[model samples]
Target: MDTLCGFMRDIGRHLSKPVVMTAEGGYANPVLGFDPAADRVVLLAQPRFS
Candidate 1:
């Protein structure tokens, strides 16, 4: 996760607009947290497939 955040920061720095990362469609457990320093929201959840 740290690696992902690092990549996001690096990419975000080069871009003019804000960056929002979202993950979808998985059967793993969710990870919920907030990074105040980066002002980033990390959300992980499983997708509902019928």
Candidate 2:
């Protein structure tokens, strides 16, 4: 999660628009807490953690 936030912040510096994030293949992990750095998060499917 720290890596993701850091990457977002680094990329956001170059862009004029807000960052929208979506992750794949992280269903096995717990749901992530929201980060203020990201303007929006788009989850296309429900995550199954088991």
lDDT of each model, Cα atoms only?
A: 0.54, 0.50
Candidate 2: misplaced stretches above 4 Å?
23-50
Q: List, residue by residue over 1-50, the lDDT tens digit for candidate 2.
A: 66875566555555634454545766554333333455433343466699
> Model 1 over residues 1-50: C-alpha lDDT tens digits?
78777666566666633445543753254444344455564554455699
Using all chains and alpha carbons, the TM-scores for the candidates as numbered come to 0.42, 0.39
**Best candidate (score: lDDT):** 1
Which residue pairs come into collision in candidate 1?
none
Off by over 4 Å in 1: 25-50
Cα displacement (angstroms), candidate 1, residue 25, comes to 6.2
RMSD of each: 7.2, 6.6
